[model samples]
Target: MDYIHLNEMEFYGYHGVFAEETKLGQRFRLTLSLAVDLKQAGETDELKQTVHYGEVYGLCKDVVEGEPKKLLEAVAEQLASRVMEDFPLIKGVRVLLVKPDPPIPGYYKSVAVELTRGIFV
Candidate 1:
């Protein structure tokens, strides 16, 4: 099917395995691809026929900035779960979570995890 994409959503949170990491927190970037049937919305031109992306953005902000998870995988899971729960038209979700900076001693753009959940998976 069809897709609605929300890209490069940024947030700050404490999410890491290290002690300092949990205390200091870091920036996170999230991207969501919502699998949905947009034909109804396109045809009817009704807001309810499609997923409201504004609500989705708030939901992503809450999950990414709310809790401290040791792994990006867990964060991705939570986000995917919520999207499926709150939006009925959303058949599935693809969550891409990025940790812009980590305590790891290396040179890289970032560390990230991608999760696919529900019918879209």
Candidate 2:
């Protein structure tokens, strides 16, 4: 098994439970890992034989920057499901979503949610 990872991809979006949060918007970071068999691509040296990371990045960007969701879990879920559906070659996917500035009373760095989807075969 081989992994393709996109770490700390940033986006600005309106996604939160509070009305103020939705209106003001904030920065979010995402990390995505795709599991696949790289034997064919490595041997053949063909782009088509492996997952196209550029396309995967575009898909992640679209999910992060598209519709607003009340929870980071929803965002992560949607991204993982979409990736599995769109890229059938990928056996599994892991998504990590981070909100650098959460709407909270205390001083904290960030809040995050991690989700994994699909089956390994």
**Cα lDDT of all candidates, in order?**
0.91, 0.90
Candidate 1 structure quality by residue, lDDT tens digits, 1-121: 9999999999998888999978988899999999999999999999999999999999999998898898888889999999999999999999999888888898999989988887774
Residue-wise C-alpha lDDT for candidate 2, range 1-121, written one tens digit per residue: 7888898999988899999878999999999888999999999999989999989989988988889999999989999999999998999998989999998989888999998887643
Provide the lowest-lDDT 10-residue window in model 1: 112-121
lDDT score for candidate 2 against the true structure: 0.90
